[model samples]
Target: MRIRATVAAVSAALALSAFAVPAAHAAGSTLDVTFSSMKVNSGKAITVGATSTVKVKATYTLTHPSGVSVANVLSGPVLYRGTSAKDADTQVVSDAPGTCTTVSSTTLHCSATITLPASDLYNADAGTWKQGGVAVDAKSGVQKWQNDLGTIPVRRAAKLTADATPEPVKKGGTITVTGKLTRANWETGKYAGYATQPVKLQFRKKGSSTFTTVKTIKSSSTGALKTTVTASADGDFRYSFAGTSTTSAVSSAADFVDVQ
Candidate 1:
């Protein structure tokens, strides 16, 4: 495991923006902090209107000037509304603080959870968001020893719904499968069909544990799913969307077919 001690290379694999490092007016910097074991929802996908979201957790070690024990740490996902700091909006993404716990003289940990309603993220421009930590002096509150936790990609939510028709069919007969692919539209506050996208048809025998790809199909102009397969055995069929850079992936529920 590579231990990251890059004091200069502020950006880690998770990709945080240039440190806004709140200015510290103290003498020779108030404190020095190092953060590690940073975990952000296991780097999971975040969606709008999602509740009870525990976005980030991290451990820290601190060094203070002339024996001033550290105070609190403020950390969480910080969002810059646009592509740059000049954007009109900037702030932490959660309502909760990056609550911290001290385990030793130089070791501590922190975490934050948020339930952002649609207004918090759905309307924001698509771009990179950051997670980070900051140290404050116990006596004075000058922020310092800040470290960037990482980043979590923000993408539009997508959904896949499917159905296989002619449920009980002759063993050698044809069964039609249909489905649709849709994605969140922030402006309209609705989910709309995504057209001309590649989706895969997958199947698993009712008793088998594996699902094999049957074929790749494309959605129609209206994001409609229409495909036919020759029935051979009782099994479950589903559709999966591989997803694009601007959207999240999704898979439809299994639709079982009874072969007579």
Candidate 2:
């Protein structure tokens, strides 16, 4: 009787183990992840060097069985871009795991403060950048979910500076205005001049807020600006750059000049 009981116990345990393995692997229903929204610069272009951290938001919904819980959610810059060393997958932008707040049984509010290093931004091309998110299930290792947060243009940051010679000048005198145009150069690790680009010379009366564009001047080979203008009234002078496909527009601080 003892030998018979031991054999029966072993057989029952083996049967339970066989049934459990199949049930765990054959989880039913497809897992779905829907991101209702994402915000990056109000759905506009992203200007690198404008900020160190990229703040993004997304609302997500996971649809699976009632007992399944989300394992991980991630958001970062990615490419459905061309095959190139620089364009290869999202190696430049590191994985940013989102810390989500639960809203309901199947819904989650997620966000990630992603950091795009200056070096990466400096090397990456200025074009359409995609924000993607992914979700995983904890219980059933078989579930997979992915959604596109959105896409936005990423551009380089440019700089402009202006100065007027002989700040105190007699009325009706010819004053020379000098300035420089520069932007980030990843290869050189320096702020290099951006030449042959059109920039506007603008002026505003000391008491007035409105600025009138006096003339358009192009930068020289060294990105230097040297233009002479007749000083009439006490006013402020500056330069404005209309950015290119790879760079963002920028304007210099107003340089105040005193006219006697």
| Tens digit per residue, CA lDDT, model 1, 193-229 | 8899999999999899888999999999988999999
lDDT of 1: 0.60
Instruction: List pairs with backbone clashes in candidate 1.
Output: none
How many clashes in each structure?
Answer: 0, 0
lDDT of 2 at 131: 54
- Local accuracy of candidate 2 as per-residue lDDT tens digits, 10-101: 22222122111222543574345555565545676666653333433333333334554555423222222333312234322223445577
Q: State the lDDT at 15 in candidate 2.
A: 18
Residue 159, model 1: lDDT of: 84
- What is the Cα-based lDDT of residue 194 in candidate 2? 82
Worst 10 residues of 1 by lDDT: 1-10
Residue 188, model 2: Cα distance from true site in angstroms: 2.8
